[model samples]
Target chain A: MISIRNLTKRFDGNTVWENVNLEIQKGETVVIIGGSGGGKSTLLRCINRLVEPDSGEVVIDGVNILSPGTDINAVRRKMGMVYQHFNLFSHLSVLENIILAPMKVAGRSREDAVAEAKQLLARVGMAGRENTNPADLSGGQKQRVASARTLAMHPEIILFDEPTSALDPTMVDEVESVIRSLSEDGITGVIVTHDLQFARRIATRVVFLADKGICEEGTPEQLFDHPTKLQTQRFLYRSRMFEQDLSPETLDLYALASELRAFLRRYEHERKQEKLLPVLCDELLYPVLKHPEAPAAGASLRLLCSETSSRHTMMIGFRGIDSDPLEEPYLDELNLALLNNYAEFVLSRKKDDGWEVCIQM
Target chain B: MTIQKTLQGSALTVAPEGRLDTITSPQLESELRADMNSVTDLVFDLANLTYISSAGLRVLLSAQKAMNKKGTMVLRNVKPEIMEIFEITGFSSILTIE
Candidate 1:
């Protein structure tokens, strides 16, 4: 168990946060999420005394580790940290990197440390990669090894600082699964990240850190779906969004569909929504291109997919178009039927030079 | 898109592999045009077809109309993702699937 009382931090004259308080139970995974430079990572570091707070009581198991006479190294032995860049020793093999801390810091025998290292590697899905160099592995692989190295210390808590920040989109799931398994094993975790979707998946309790202090804190569903604060709502809405430019002559519907599928997959959308996304592109977007008066290029598309709401909304704005594509005389029967069936609502409005259509599904 | 055609005694089987979209549908339309008069029975194997767009559907609709005059056209082994597209556009009712 850990508790923080009256925490404060400042960099030169700029105050990061003040009077911050939080509590962590034995097995709870608490995720601290917010925009960049909000002291989320600094708060995590202050817990381990990696970044000393200007004033605070970081009491871990009845010991105030932030106090003057406290043994910082001994306190840190119980807390493991996995960094964004996966700070593994480049010259050491995977096994050696993991075993070094256990043998040197914990005073375990080489055979004992090595055996435990192999088991930790297996737990993180890197079982057969014991002799591989850190430089030889992928970003995801290196992070898993960094995690295994941390686990070798047998710490009661693990602190992750943007664990998936450097990973390829395809490799994020592998690292996320490892972190999820650790929570299942009843290790208290404090993760600071910009990734809201990952926080939604991993957090037992969510904390929103912004504007120099705690903005809100609640369960993932309560915070993501029904945040009471206006700041939290705006952050959630703006985080899961994308924009693109469409060229009618060169647009590849299949490629666009795949791109949309990947974006939805990142947020862990429902199967029904996934199936309908491509249909939305084909029936709704394709009709605009097929319209006789449609422009050759310069169509702007913006999509905002909200985890808080059931609807996924898209706005398509076209320049140099005289007529609205959704008008009665332009839209064909089959395409209209598909549009009515797939979308919740469709509206078209006029602009100075062109027009825009907003569809919600 | 790659189309593999097998013609045995006027019954032609045309199998398209990969996506049938705006870019590739015209190629399929021209291929069918070149061989239309010599064929009586048409079979389309869609087992390898990954996707289809409205342009592809228009080509299929015209083929079905042309086949109605003197022959029959049938599609087989449609993947579920592609079949949903057909069902959405009401092509499932117009095209014969086996």
Candidate 2:
């Protein structure tokens, strides 16, 4: 169980979020959802003291995380974080990565760590691949191995920051499948992700983070379909766009904006690779082009305008299909993230073989 | 649905409060219809009623129609709040209310 009151985080005087109050009950899975810079990751970091919050106390079970007498590392040992980059020691084998943390920190013996690592590898569906090097494994396999590695720590709760963002399309389901199983087993977790379906399926409770605080907390069925905040609606829409094609040559400004959002989501689930969605839709672009007073496409003014209000200006005509979206047979605990943050998105059927999405306001 | 019965000679008044949902409506219906023959006048006190979703509405309608064929049926203390909802949904015309 975790209780946070009046939590605040700032970066060089820029406040990321403040007055954040949350209480997560024991054996509960709380999924955090929000847009970039909404403080999803910063909140997680503050909890683990990875980033010292400006103020507040985080009490886990009974002890305050910031207590003078609290043994931070010892308390952290009960919590494990999985990174998107698959933070495996490149020189270490899959089996070695799993055993390393437990051996060094938990003081697990070599023989005991090895035995536990093998079992973890099997649990994550990488039983025979334990001996494989990080480079030899596929992206999804690497993440699975990373998960097994984290599991080796034997923490009471695991925190994931976009665990499936690095995997290929086909590989994502595998990672999600694994996570779903872990959640079914009731392994308490606080995941920061753009994956709506993951929260719907695996989370016992969902908290929408935005506007310098928690926008709302309730059952997924209530928040996803019946969210009360304008920010939550926007975040959910952006998350669904990740699967669509964003032409590679989109403007740098748009790319930068995309990275900013990805950073926030990653801070929660720990994904390393970030994506940039295609810039300004045609309907949105026409207004910029026909600006009777503006210059050409490459004009600085045109670029500046696009970066400022592109999300609000553009409208995608289609809602693409999500085949096997939630029935993630592959990636366990993986939820679909808003891969693209650009507002002017089109659900191009030509790309994903023509998928129609169910739309809800 | 929770039911409270008050008997004045053969004239019986029953107030079923709270929700009359799919899971609870049947209990009230059974209790009422099971002893229908012993009643001459019937009155339903709906003052405490707050919600009448479709399932609840259906039961109330049926009971009213059944009572119409048996004896006098009047809905007493029909709160304005419930009355407005019934009127909006065009259910007020179907029931005898005071």
Candidate 3:
């Protein structure tokens, strides 16, 4: 069990987060979700004393590791961190990578470390990659080896700092699956990531960090589907938009509308509102569905909708298109008029293959 | 998708059944291209169309552009779902939907 009481941190006079109090129960997978540079990773680092906190206590199992005379290395040994970039020794083979920590840090014999490393590699689904060098392996494979190395330490808690962010889209699921398996095995995990879908799948609890501390914390369903706080809702909405932009896919219009309606109904239920559906559909959903972009075959238009009591956010992402539809001269006036009338703000940006239009009302 | 054609006077009606997605849009495009020159009025009967993606919209845009010079293009019995696609892409204003 880890308890953070009034944990605060600052970097070169800029406060990252202040007075952040949170409790990670044993075996609970707590995911920290927030905007970039909001101290999500810093909170993880502070827990392991990698970035020393400005003030406050980081107590793990009644031991205040931040106190003077505390064995910081021993405390760190209890927490394993998997970085955004696979911080593996490129010169070391996969087997060597995993065994190095156990043999040197834990003082285990090379044979014993090798045996454990093999098992950890197998557990992380990298059994046959023992002889492969880190440079020779793919990003996902290297991350797997990194995870295996962390597991080699047999830490009670694993801190993941955007482990899948550096991976290719195709390889993200593989690493995520590995992390999911760890949660199933009852490992206490503190994951700081922008991957909301992954967090929803693996997190036992979700913490939204904003404005110097935790703005909201709840179960993934509660936080994602119906976030009570404004910051939580905005962060979730933006995070989903980013995810859509990265891997856009063609969506059935009817199915998407149905999903949006269902989401709105759930949101209304959480907010205890009556008669919000009709207004949302007519005002927000209808206008968003009206934007025109001519995408080539196999291209996709992805949509995401999120609403709070006072405002609504709709994100439409277009990908794999041959030409930018927003560049069409005929659409300039119409898009401007639509934005002026229906949305409080309309932001459109060029993406990899297509464009993204975000409408907030 | 199954396409049914009915010719009356100078109008040619192409009725497409099922989804007009990325895979099927070209089928509709080629079908229209073959007869578009002869027809003065182009009508798309979308009663049975269950879905339309950006791919489908592109074909429709091209058809509308072509018809603007020589003929009048109209989309009839447009499903709310398909209509939403038109509305989303600003195709409703460009293409006459009834």
Candidate 4:
């Protein structure tokens, strides 16, 4: 139950966005995504009056929050915001952090606040961790506590400003699951995130913010799969790529694997596809491209992981190698078999000064 | 990677913790090389082993070949991910895995 009419914002002389119009129904989880500096986070802030818009009204339940006559504090009490850096009080225990707002702001007794805090903690998968200090908690746990603290206000709407940005790749799923469960319970949410996969998973409606305004907005399937705008297509396509240059002499396979894992996990690729990454590095790159005797020495190698329209492909480009490792008789028989069994297709092509090997997964 | 070795007479049990990738495989290879001659039964406890590469597979292959001549070699607690690698490369048919 929120409506924005001709909303605009500016910093100094530069306009961030102009003439933005959007509507959010009750129980709708709306996700806002855009490039950095596109004012996605700023727009979310405008909703809660954290950043006052330069023009137009943000009307929530027929009350223009931008109006000075409106009771801002009363309106804010109905909305809760979770931030990227969990703004949990570092000195406080988990229980204290959650119960603080409810007891002080809502004028509830400590006994009542504590009882509700425990239930909120358990709901966010933080049960039995109430006594632990905020510093002792993981990034994901702290975010969950921040969410629970926000929920402690019992707000009608929750605004997430890049909720998973500070988390480790392995921990993103936990916080995402908590947010997802909240949406299932019919909590109206408006999220500002660069994480498209998270947005895809959580958003009932997706909005793309760019070029000083709302560029496009649609369902996840429509926006992600068949975006009518060229900018939206370019953004979604470029977002999935994981590119890296190889240093053969001091190559750390474990570090590479973990980095690749983190990148792939952001897009929420299947576990099977992720598992094959290390194998590709060990069996394909190590034996053929990175080996000392492989004639790829001093070569600049670029590995690009491309996810296009749900099809996953990895292209390995070797800048100095003349011969194709896939076609050469020197390629190990066992390695060939392994590659053949896993990959849908393995093809090689000559670029300007290098050979690119594309493996479809 | 940490290698925990338990040697009781001719039976040698080697437990490798963490990844058995390109860098650490050589360490495991050299560690096993030092005691291969006297050992009759080789047990690789892989409960704590989280990962393995083709380089690690080669080390196990060599170990199996060495044990075939004098004793027996068996792998214990092989993780499903590692087992998938073994099965793909036909190591499952060659190696004794538990």
Tell me the native contact fraction for each prediction.
0.37, 0.00, 0.00, 0.63
Candidate 1 regions exceeding 4 Å error are A243-361, B1-98
Candidate 3: pairs in clash: A289-B88, A290-B87, A290-B88, A291-B88, A291-B89, A292-B89
Off by over 4 Å in 4: A243-361, B1-98
lDDT of 4 by residue, A1-361 (tens): 8999999999997999999999999889999998888999999999999999999999999999999899999999999999999999998999999999998999999999999999999999999999999999999999999999999999999999999877754478999988888888778999998778889988999999989999999999999999999999888887466677775676666787788778766653566677677767776777655656555543343334432222365777766677776765425666666666666667777867667777766
Misplaced by over 4 Å in model 3 are A239-299, A303-361, B1-98
Select the stronger candidate by DockQ from 2 and 4: 4
Candidate 2: residue A28 lDDT (0-100): 80
lDDT for residue A194 in candidate 4, whole number 0-100: 79
Candidate number with the higher TM-score (1 or 3): 1
CA error at residue A228 for candidate 2, angstroms: 1.7
DockQ of each: 0.22, 0.00, 0.03, 0.35
The positional error of residue B26 in candidate 1, measured at the CA in angstroms, is 14
Chain B fold agreement for model 2, TM-score = 0.85
Residue-wise C-alpha lDDT for candidate 3, range B1-98, written one tens digit per residue: 89999988789999999977655778999998888878889999999998765557778888888889997999999998677656765788888988
Point out where model 2 deviates above 4 Å: A237-361, B1-98
RMSD of candidates 1 onward, in order: 15.7, 27.1, 14.8, 15.0
TM-score of each: 0.57, 0.54, 0.56, 0.58
Among these predicted structures, which one has the highest TM-score?
4
Window of ten residues with lowest summed lDDT in model 1 chain B: B19-28
- Return the DockQ of model 2: 0.00
Residue pairs in collision within model 4: none
Could you arrange the candidates by TM-score from highest to lowest?
4, 1, 3, 2
